[model samples]
Every structure is written in structure tokens, then in C-alpha cells.
Target: MVIGAPASGQGKTTVATGLMAALSRAPYGLDVAAFKVGPDYIDPGYHALATGRPGRNLDPWMQGEERIVPLLLHGALHTTAQQPNPARIAIIEGVMGLFDGKAETEGFASTAHVVELTESPVILTVDISHASRTIAATVGGVAAFEEGVKVEGIILNKAGSPRHADEVKRALRRLGIPVLGVLPRDEAIHVPSRHLGLVPAAERDESRQALDALAQRIADNVDLARVVKIAMTAPRLSARPWDPAAEVHPPVAETTTRPRIAIAGGRAFTFRYAETTELMEAAGCEPVEFDPLRDPALPPDTAGIYLGGGFPEVHAEELSANASMIASIREAIDAGTPTVGECAGLLYLCREVDGHPMVGAVDATAAMGPTLVLGYRDADGTRGHEFHRTTTTPAEPTMAPNVHASYLHVHWAGAPELAQEFCDATHAYASSRPDLKHHGDTEVGEGLVDLAVNVRLPGPPAWMTEAIMATLPGLGAYPDATAARAAIAAFHGVTPEMVLPTSGGAEAFTLIARAIPGDRPVVVHPQFTEPEAALLAAGRTPHRHVLAPPFTLDVDALPPTDLLMIGNPTNPTSVLHDGEALRDLAGPGRIVVIDEAFMDAVPGEHESQIHAEMDHLLVVRSLTKTWGLAGLRAGYVVGDPRLIARLAAQQPPWSVSSPALAAMVACTTDRARVEAQLAVVRTTRDRDHLIESLTTLGWDVVTPAAGPFVLADSHDPGTRARLRVRGFAVRRGDTFPGLGPHWIRIAVREPSVTDALVEAARV
Candidate 1:
């Protein structure tokens, strides 16, 4: 069951949470598992509090639609089969309204997206107060906007009076849509919203009261029997799991010896999805739990470490005061131990979190900030919000050898090999038992990794050759025939055509340079390193125009270049320039090439330049940095007839194939997924309070940051490396040319990740 609203605050969560609570206490002894559709942490908490079960987030963007059914089935079947219950149900709550998403139309991040993917009918929670008859138009628009999306029923929230409920019910019944329930306007039942949507139930002390009251209200008001009948009457699905074990990425090969993988759990690291931890277990390691706040020290048996995401900033004082644990963690990591830190975990591993003295594990300081750094991750494809209360300082070297730390929270595409290597190295130092002894280098702490399973591939994709070949094809033979076969041999996993290689974004630009020929070929500057480079390489003296100082483009400055090249949210400056303005600039005898490489960092697709419908407009997209597939060289140009034709002819046949094509098809085909990503972006933005904090610290911030990164001028004239010693690695302005050195580009990370930066930059 997917429950959602036209937008947030329509009471989808309240109704869903209430329903779960009511059912948990039912006489049926039903085993029910709750899940959220996107990257939400708050609603899941409410679900968990209501159901007395862990509510997993089933994000198709993060994992896949295949994983959705399997995860749901796994959570349901695993728990029910073990319990004394014979019946079970799974309830999935959604993000936004039905049919709102990142695509050309609504439903981009809408519950409708999940409905299509899961084959689940929607129970829309419409906020019906002022609007009455027009509600029909709203419902019709949602139902007709996309075919096959089932809006099986509607729940009228905040109905004015009993008469109002009757009127609305009669109207919805006329449309043949069932009005599941009508919730009266009860100020006593309101859930609070903070910077990051509604406050997560875990963080709310009154959540139990709210949930209990909500459940009683829903039980009293809603037709519980009808809902149960509707639920049972809905087509009974095969008990088969959504993602059968055989269908998921196979478990890693296990080692003869078990490695004790020390994981930071408790509340701080609770943000992690169960799949990642399960994968680690399947890989031949025993995951041990330790709280950074409560635990006094690392478990004596701990070998490797996995620190998933949670709220470190909220409990900064407690974490800071845990001196013994902090020292033990630092000692473990410093002594050649392998560690992976995500979101809050990343913040905890830093030198000092916020203004409080911390473990000093990594060589960085953390500080509090008032902005959120959020987005849908290009990796893992999960959409949810991230809100940690810290950021790292001297940010240049956020990564260290054995310890990998970043605010970038993703599940797949993570460096599993790095994890494997850390496990291998750590196990080398552990005390060897006769039964546990296996490979070389077994010692003290090293024994922990002996149990770990290594699932990482030996190297990156074979299509990684695109960037190299584009740069130095002459080093090898007439690469076509031999390179294709050699690529197949090298990968041993895929076909050659599946690897359409390019020379960075330069090759993509080269394709555009040749396709759009004219006396005036415009180059969008401060956006990417290559658009101008490619035009220059192609011998087209490109016309150039910088955006206005505040980072917004003055539409009047846009000249008709016959061929115009513009970057959405112009690159180095990280300005989310208006898409409509770029559309206005395109016309007859003109070709507009839009670089959307940075556009994915923003949450919604509506913010992207791809929305323009001009026949001459061509948009170039890259998965490199966004998805950390930079080494993969997977990018494509989307354009109208003549432009696509010209660009296609310039490329060799069967350019993009196996993996690159697969990853691309996997990413672009699902519009619901990308919008789901936006929830995360919004999460980061609200939690970090990045813009507000930066502005307070005297930095000029670009408003309405639609891109993942923000460009700002620092009050101080410190080199980025200088900031590195303090623990941050920021993109300096000099690399962007026309921008002065005082300017820096900060990637929107988790709130805790940005908080450290804010502290480091404190005036």
C-alpha cells in the first residue's frame, strides 16, 4: 500500500502511521512491515514507532524496483515466518503527491511513480479545506496525467465539518474513486514540520502520544472494516519475494575465516539501509555493533569498521565527552585499520565536531551550520533527505589512506574494493587460530577481516578507456577492431559496443562542436572545463559571455550565436541559471547546446534545462562526478532531429554499450527515481542550513541553489590546501578562470558535513 499527498503536509504520514498502529493491535496477529518509498528518515521512524517493527525505506532510485519487492517480501516473510503469525502485510508510504516527479510533468517524485513500479494502488491524502468542486479537476488531472497509475482511493484530510466531508465524499464517489476516510480538522493531531519537512518521530519526544492519538482517531473515524476488506480484496499477490535472492547482485565469496567487522550502530549510524549491512554479512564478516556515544571503546575483537549515517550533531556533547571511545576509535583507525564513514559517521571521524572537541579520528574539524546540503545521489539512485548537524573543516583532504570519509552518502558504486583491501589488511594483524588461520599476514587486529567476503571487481569498467582513447588513441594500434576485442577480453564481462568512450566531457563537446556549425558558436563558460576546450579543439572560435556577478544570467546578455553553448547553473560559478531564459535564447538558424552535467545535483527535473521544447536545442548530460562514474566516461547528448543526426554521424558506430549503456538506461528510464533523489537534496539543504550559515559568515551566497554545489566568495584569502590542514578539500575559484581566488565551490553534502565547513570558516 502506497499512501501520499498532492504535496507534503496533507497527512499521508499521519494516516499511514495511524493505520499501521491500529493493525498491529488487531486480533488477526498480522505480521506487518512498513517502508517508505524514497530517502526519508522521518516517516520511517513514525512507521517504526507505530508498527513495533523496523520500517525500511524501499527506494527504487537507491536500489532498484527489483529490490523493492524482494526487500518488502524479505522484511515481511523473514519476520512473519519466524513469528507465530500466519498472516502478514506490507505498507509503503510515499514522498510527494501522486504523479509529481522530476520528469517533464508531475509525478516525478510523486507517489504515482512508485505505484507504477510496485503495482500498488494509491491512497491519496488530499488536503480538502477551501477547495471543493475543483477537487474533481485535481483528481482527474492526476488520474489522466499518466495512464496505468491506479489512484484506487482517496482520503480527505482536514475536512471542514461533517457536511463538508459528505459533500467531498459524494463528489469523489461520482468520479468512481473510493473515499477511504475523511479526517476532521483536529489541531490536536498536527505533526510539526522543521527545516527538513516533518520532524522525524525518533527525534520527537511526543511521537508516541502523536502516534497513539493518531491511531485512535483514525480507528474511530475511518472505516477500518472497509479498509481491511479492500486490502484483502485487492488482487492477492504470489508469496514470491519482490527481489528473489537469485535475482539480486550475488553475495560475495566468503573467506574461510570470519572477520569481525565493527559497525557503528545505535542511533548515530541508524541511517543505513539494511541491504548494505546484509551485504557486508554475506561477504563473510560478522558485523559487531558499537555506539560512538555509549560504548567506552572499540570491541576488543573488532577488525574492520563500517560507520553508516545518523545524527552526530544532535548528540555532539555526549559523543565529545566519550573520551575513552574516541581515543580507542582513533587508535584503531590510525593503526592501519580500514574504516568507511557516511554522513554523520563522516562527521564523527573528524578532528572535532562542531565547537565541541571530538575524537580527532580524521584530520578535520567540524562545525554547525544552518543550511541543508541535500540531493538525490547519482550513485545508488536513492532519493531521501540527509540532515546531520556538522561539517568538516580544511576540507581538501577529507579522504585518508585506510580511512575513507565523505558527506556523500550512497549505497552501491561505493568502493567495495577499498573495503575489501581494508578488510584484508586488518585481518593480517589478528591472532591466528588453528581453525581460522588462512592467508598470509595474520596478526592481532588483522584477524577480524579474515571472515570478510570480498565482492569487489578487480578494476573499474573497460569503457573507462573512452577518456584515455580520446586523449591518446595513437599509443595503441588502429584501436577500433583490436580495441573492441581487447576491451571484451579485458572486461571478461561485457561486449565492446556497450562501451562508448569519450575524452572526458571534451569528446561529448567535440560531437557537439561538429554537429553545430556556424560563424558564431557560443561557449558557456564557468560551467564545465570542456565546452570551450572542445570548440577550441574543433577550430571554432567560440563566442563567450560570462553570467552576471550574482551568478544569475542576464537574458539580455545572451546573444544569438547561431550556436549557443550554455551550462545549466553555469559550472564554476554553480549558478542555477534560469532554463526558461535559455529557451528564450533559442530560435531559427540557431542551435543551443545545454550542458546539464551539474544539473543532476539539483533534486527536481523541472529545474533542469532539458524541459525546453525547441527543435534546435541540444542538451549534454554526464554521469561522471554526479554518480562518481567519472572514470566510466558515460555521457550522452539529447537533441532534436538535425542536431542528433549530426552528432550521431560524428561518433563511431556502437559507441556506448554493455555497462555504460546499462547504467545509463538504468538511470534515465526511471523519472520517479531522480525526483526521489531531490528529497535528499532538499534534506541536505535544510539540515546543513548551508546558505543561511554561509551568508551569516559574510560569504556572498547564490540564492535558490538548484545545483548540487554552491559558489561563494570567502571573507578570508586562505588557499584551499590551507583549509585542507583544517580538514576540507574545497574546489577553489582559480580552477574556474574568470572567478577570483576568493571564490570556492562547495558540494552540497550532509548537514553534518557542511556544518564542519561552516565552523572552519567562522569569522
Candidate 2:
């Protein structure tokens, strides 16, 4: 495994890729597989190019490093099939610095964290062009920082000359450190960078040549034989028993029977985890593979179909050109094939994806929208996220169904009901049931014949349900209705009659839009979509002025209007506007609404507009995202008493459920609880420090990025994709209009996740 500092210009990727490439080309016929630390996609591309194997990322924050060994072993077994003697060496490229994740917490989410998880020796890559002997001091500090992270060798990059290399060697000699190699400055071989970091290797033609050049250069300078010997001497890891085939074996009675499930494979359907298909096979179902880009038909006997994630969008033109395959899959699904589509698979099932004609299976056209669709959503308890860019046509399903073909990257966290619900919905469709046609064109397949077609989706799995339910009691302990009324009275300095509780920021935004008596209102640009969407639904044009250059809000850009909406510390960019300047915009004729979704994050309540009159200044607050009660969707809007009453009338009776309402009241009343959560924000600042570290390395960071996120430009597409393969998913830059094509957004969740982000950038 190779580790480097946090930022894109770092040499971790080059070192790891070169090692893999050189090792794979050995005369011993060593078959190598690669794994990158964190949730990046680009570095894995280079790793793949080097070893002729798929590169996977190990994210401790998402799946934890425990999942790495299983994937590694599986990849090993897979390589063995290609080569009789598989190389035991699994080249892992680490994220960020050796110990720079989450906070001052040592080895929290750093490369050191995963190194400890995998028990791998580390090769520390240092940029030594400017400093020679000091490089040793740098190496010594990192080696001594953590005993668990075994820094076996150092690759000094950008060495000025032989004298400079000697100086670095002398410095390292004093510290008893081994200098693996000295790399001279070579801009010809430097990987390009963009806002999201390195562009994906698959998207670059020179990526292969770059890897080859790097490998040859390293081989010429570095002791390749010595490195190989070190790798060979590394102790073999104990076999993990997490294989799907071992955990979920089919019965002997079902030995000769074919599987009921059919999964699309090949390049188009290649994003699926091998475990998913294996799980299906173990469940007494045959998991068949088909190529969506070339297959003329689904497996003739495929009872159900699964199209996992892949790069269908990237290859949309090719997919569209293959009209025969698209038509065949559509016919099969329409004839009752239980299809489960996700990410790219979702794009394939749609009518048109990004202007290209796709299989008209799901009624919706998937367009390459200007906005990126990404977020860590609580869709099915798996807490998975979406990391792609594309918008669906209006014909898409609006609710849950058996054939859920959407961009939601769902994780199978024992949400058996979801699967069963899907199967049931599919069965309903096959039965020609109208109720099943809640949205879009429901594909009707052949009804289950001579079989019960029973599906087993585990009920909100036990452990997850406990995790989900834990929020309730913590929220339930908050103030009662009477106490909440008192807090509201204190906040607005008015009677409790003026305040009303809602579901969340969504409900608050929706209610405010419904209550406000306005025809021509303008929404500030680059804000949350809910408020503007609500206003537009109410027949309001709502002109917008997106944040201009540098993402600094300009008051002059506002459209002349009496009603204005804004998300303080905007989403996507997390830009915080000056409260004083905002107040100046609120004149006698104007009503300014602020969605302070993240105001709690900003110290000092004085930054909020709530201090102004409730009548003219509508302030919305949520205990969801801040307190991690997003699933509960609990929040409230403080405004004029008359307006609040009007907004309340627009809602159905008890629109906010008893549980949800109680949770909201409880959360708002507990000042101590809220303050306690603020302590965690310190970790977020340290994460910001890492991003600041990136700017020194030539990254163009977006300003007004104080709240748990930042935007930056990498200016290279290949770097962006390589970052993806590294287990780090950065929001693509082109999605937001004000931001240019090279811009990318990084959300600050945990310190560990941030550390991974920093590590990815350094790569």
C-alpha cells in the first residue's frame, strides 16, 4: 500500500500504479489485482490499467475496512482464474496523509486506518524537489507518528539533482529509513487534474502510456527486485469467511437446477458486486449474465432480471446505437421480467437517457441534466448514496414499486420488504393490476406459473432498525407541546399561538410558500430547490440570481420583488451570505424568507435573520440534518401569526405524524443536546484544514465554503475518475450552473470521511 499527503498533486497514485504495472509485467507471470483506499473512482482506473484487473476501493466510513479483505480475496480468486498462479500482492493506494482524518484522532480515517485494517506494509511517497535532507525528518516524523503504520520504504519524487538525492539519502540514513528510489521532476508524465481531482483513467487515452512510463521510470530508479522481495516477505493474511457463496449456499436438492434470476453482465452491466450475483445463486436461483449492449435477448428462461450499476451513461451513444438489444430487453421486461435496476442500469431501463434513445422499458426518459444527482439518503436503511449526474423524465415512478428503476444507489441493508415489495409490485403488474401503475408505464410480465414466486426481503433488518429507532427516544425526551410553545414564545417574543410545527425543512418551506400571499416572488439562486419548487407550483415565476463569481452573494443581483427566498449557507456550495447585507435588502415592501438549514453550524445566532420581526422575516429551522434526524423530518417555521395560521390551513389534518411532531418539539427544546452536537463540528474544521492544504498544491478552492463542504477545480477529467476508484465520490462540478465544468463539491460528514477526501485529492 502507498500513502501520501492530502491533495491531488501528491505522488501516491503514481507510485501505486507504477508498482502494480511493473509487478504485473514480471517474468514470473504474477497476476495482480488492485484496491484503492476510500470511495474514489479515478485511481482505480490507473490501477486497472496497470494490472489488467478491476480496481475496487475500500471505504471505512461507508462499508468499513473489514469489507476490504473479502473484496480482496474475491479479486484474488478471480485473478487466479485468469492466471494459474495469482500474485499475492494486492496494490492498495491509500487516501490523504498517513494520519490526517476526522481530527487529531490518530489513525481515525487516514491511510494509517486502512493500513492497520489490512495489515499491509506502507511505501511513503514524498515530494522532495524543494527539500533534500529535510525529507528524512519528514519520513521520521510519519514513521514515528503511529507504530501500527509500518513505513517500509520511501519514494522521493521530483528530486532536483544527484546532489539533492544524496542529501535526502543522508537525511534518511540518520533516521535509519530506506530510500526506495529517487524520481526526477517530469511534467511530461504528470497526471492531469480537475475540480474533482484526477480524471478517470478510462476517460483518458494517455492513461495507459502514463502508467507504462511511470512503471519504467520507477523500475530504472527504484530497486524493483528489493521491493518485490519485501512484498513476498509480507505475511499472508488469514482467509476471511465473508464470501457470499460460503455464507449463502444453495441446497443440494437444488444442485442441478438453473437459477431464477438473470443479471446483465459485460461492460455495460459490469458495475455490480460479484457478491450480489453470488447471493442470488446461493438463494436457489440461477444468476445468469447477459450483455445489455450486445445481447439480442434476455436469457430465455430468466425468471427475473437484475441490471446493476455501470457506465451506461458514459457509453450512452453506443447503447443507443444498439437498438436491437434495447428493444429486446424492453420486450422481455414488458413481458414480465422482474427487473431490478440501479444507477447506470436505471438509465438503460428508461425511454431516453441524456438525449440518447434507450430501452423504452420504464416510461421515463433519462436526460443528462445540468444538475448532478447525489446525496447520502436514508432510502432503504442501508444509508447508501447517489454519485451520478442525470435527471429522469416526468414519467418516472413517484413512489415505491417492484421494478424500481431509479438513480437511487440503494444498499441492501436487510430491507427485505423493499425487495419483497418490489417483487409483489412486479407480481401485481403481471396480474394487470391498475393499482400497481402508481406512476409511469408499469411493465407487465408473464404471471408466475406453477410456482409461488416468493421473495425473501428481510424486514427492516434488526440491527439497522435499532439504529433507526434510537433517534426516536432521544428526540422523544425533548420538551412537551406546552414547553415547545414556551420556547416558540421565547424565540419570536410572541404568544405560542404564532408558532406551528411541521415535518422538516421541506414542510416549513412548503408551508411558507403556500401561506405567503404573493404572485411575483424571486428566489435567490444556488439555494435549496424545495422553496422555489413550492413557489412555482403555486404559480409563481420566482426569478433567480445565482451566486456570481467566487460564490459571494451580491444584493444588487436580486430581482425587484416584495417576496424573496434564500437558503442561508446555501446547499451545494455552502456559501454563507452576510446577515447585515441581507437585512438591507428587506425594506418595507419586501418579505425576506431564510431557510437556515445550517444556521446552527454557524456560531453566534446573530448571523440569522430571526432577530428581525417574524412577520417580515420568515425563518425556517430543522433538527433533521443537524441532529441526524433526517428520517424523522422534523422542523418548524417561525413567521407572522396570521401567516402561520394560513400555512397551517393548507396542510391536511395532522400532516406531521404524532411521532414526527413529538420528535420536532423535543429536539427544539433541548438546547443542551444541540450544543453537545456542536462539539462534533470541531472535527469538521480540521477537515476544512485539509482542503486548505490542497490549495497550496494548486487546487482552485471555491470561497464561502465554511459550512461542512467546499468546491474546487481540478481542470482535468481523468483525475476526477481516478479519484472515484479511490473510494471517494466527489460531486461532479458541472451540475451546478454558477460553478464551471472543473468544479467539484465535497460534503463534510465525519472527520474520517473528510480525511479520505483529503487523501483522494492528494493522489
Report each candidate's C-alpha RMSD, comma-separated, in the order given: 30.9, 29.9
- For each candidate in turn, the TM-score is 0.52, 0.48
lDDT, candidate 1, residue 236? 50
| Alpha carbon deviation, residue 290, candidate 1 (Å) | 2.7
lDDT, model 1, position 429: 31
- lDDT by residue (93-195, candidate 1, tens digit) is 8876665554454444456766766677767778889887777668767766677676777788898998987877767766888887889999887888754
Residues 1-763 of candidate 2 have per-residue lDDT tens digits of 4445433355888888888888777553457768777555567777777888777666554554556566666666664354556556777788777775544544554677877777778778888877766677778888888777788887888888888888888878877667788888888778886433566675577877788788788778888776766566456678663555544444444434443565776655555543455456545566677776766545544467788776677678988887656655664565456778887788888778778988777788776666665544445445444667677775745522336676665433123234444434333333331121121111112331100100011122243335446557655554244545556557546667666777777777777777776545777765566776676455443555667657777788666678888877775566788887876676568878888777766655557776535656677777555555655556777766666778778866655654555454445445534553563366357547756765775877777565555666777755555666665555555434345446655555445655555666677
Clashes of 2: 54
